[model samples]
Target: MARVDLNDYVYVNARVRGMRSHLLTRDFFMRLVEADGFEALHALLEQTIYRREANEAFLLNPVRPDYDQALTLNLIAAFRKILDAVGGEPRRLVATLLSRYDVQNIKSVLRGKHGDATASEITNILVPVGSLRLEQLEVLAGQREIRDVINTMHAQQIKYARPLIDAYPDFTKKDHDLAVLELALDKYFYRDAIGQLKGKGTNTEMVRQMLVGEVDMRNISTLVRIRGVRLDDGEVENLRIPGGALSADEFLHLDRLGDIVRIVSDYPDPRYRKVLQKALAEYQEVDLVAFDRELEHEMTRRGAAMSNLDVLSIGVIIGFMWQKNNEVINLRILLRGKAMDRPQAQIRSDLFFVEREEGQAA
Candidate 1:
């Protein structure tokens, strides 16, 4: 692939900035939390960039299952628009970043296959914004066994297949545990993304830092979540990915989840340390979910700041993508909460909002 030039990103950045402005506001989410049901929430969504999706979902209301599919379609449509707006090497770089969705879709397929999910059920959850097309993922979903899926991926020469194939034995030994396969996929995606961004340019450096931060956050969250499970130190070590701010050994010896906060405090990245502290403070008063939301919001905030610093580079594009993904995530949580009849307070607590600083808010 050709390297992306900073100058080549100018037009795309301007277009993305315009699109970013249309992202749902914090107030809109507050209203969503108070929504009576999917109908009300869908109406609210119709007022935003997701209007078309909301309308389509409403038309499919009798079927209902298509609601989730509509949201996924909207996400892919948004991504496709962004991808279409750029050309050449810049588009390739963006595709590399978006390929994380490919990783996600593959993992969903493997898990569905392992659990004997019907092809329609698996197709409903698969995201098609990455390298793999929807039809290809649907075909993978139709496979009868995890091994068949892996073989198909390999026969098709998919880049992601190599890691899963190498880990297949461990997965089989672990009783087809999807977590093992998932960890392998996550590690490969992060390493592959970092490799692509390596030595590209100053523009790529900004995007690289964002990816590194993501790896660190994932490792930290994994450490916290796995503490409640029965996994031993070695098992935990196997789950950790390299190339983050912290070394694998750093997380291997942690005695408790709180120790992760202290490790974050000592991290070389000051922004991470600050976010960890804030998250820790919130965690004490509320719950671990609060901490997770804080960490995510802080990362998004920093990405936005970086985009502002270098608007005509990959940073802006990456920032917009992060914000776009967050929009979809927050909507999913809200829509699912409504569908499940969850409490307003609980759903509100679970949301990750993108709040502008006091002066910045119009």
Candidate 2:
């Protein structure tokens, strides 16, 4: 008999490919852009796969924020849909990738608490699709202080808590600087992921490459961001993530160049060089936010490209993850545009259009 993992992939890959076919297409977005208003847009969405969550959102508050909540729930539902469909090593890889959601939830909660946001405000921002249960995150958000949040995490035995706990002193030492702690979590998540995916195999290597790609872009983004922050020069070294096309020496060397455009324009690598070119061309000064967005778009584009790989490979799951994320974000943006009564052309300009390969219709 074939290996058990192969058996799992036969079913899992079929499920994923089938789901990809049903993802929202350009045609759907065009209609969405032409939607009359928020209610009309919600009405259109309710007629599709989002009906359940859209209805739940309507029942919750019947406004933009609640609709946003519904979208968040819907996105979580999408990931769970795939997770529930797979088993064995395929499931492990999926779960491993899903850990990023947990990291994001932690960051959202910490940032929200730091800003004195309401509990609901924080919870609404979370996707709750990772190992950390919604209740656990809600409790974390409910904590009065950031340290208390970290402490409660330990009390609850959250795996990510230890790193934050270890870094808490530095957080305090840096005058309660959130970036220090946030960077610690980033390092922990990526390092732990790379560590688990250490073995050699085609599928495992694919996932490793996906992760290292993230680390590379994030390190670059971090390096760019440090220029605007008050942190010590050592912060770049501290935030470096190993095993990407960009090296530590390259990162440090680039950081010292000072001019954001010149830093990227003169870089040796054509791949990363291409990514920032468009965004840099539009910037008169450093716009880290734009660079970050450009980087995220590039990553998603590359991750989504993996769907073209072998059917039974982990690429399907990885590709779906990225595309699904883009789909939801695009939906939210399109609806927001409709709500604001923006013209179709303007809204279309801002949306991330997912072009299908010639014969592949959505």
Q: What is the TM-score of each candidate against the true structure?
A: 0.86, 0.91
lDDT for predicted candidate 2 compared with the true structure: 0.81
Tens digit of per-residue lDDT, candidate 1, span 1-362: 97544338877777777887888888888988887766676677778877787687667674464556777887787788788877777877788778889998998898888888899999989878888998889889989998899899988888889999999999889887888889899999999988887565777777677888888888877766666577777777888888787776677755244455655565555656667788878887888887777878877876766665665678777777777778788878887887788898988877776665444312
Residue 197 deviation, candidate 1, in Å? 1.6
Q: Quote the lDDT for 91 in model 2.
A: 75
lDDT of 1 at 246: 73
Model 1: lowest-lDDT 10 consecutive positions = 353-362
Worst window of 10 by summed lDDT in candidate 2? 353-362
Tens digit per residue, CA lDDT, model 2, 1-362: 86434336777777778878768878888887887766777777877878898887778675444667777887898899888877777778888889899999999999998999999899889988889999999999999989999999999999999999999999999898999899889888988888888579778888888888898888777666666455455766777766677777787777777677767786767877788786675454546566687788888888887877766788888888899899888887877776677788988977886565555425
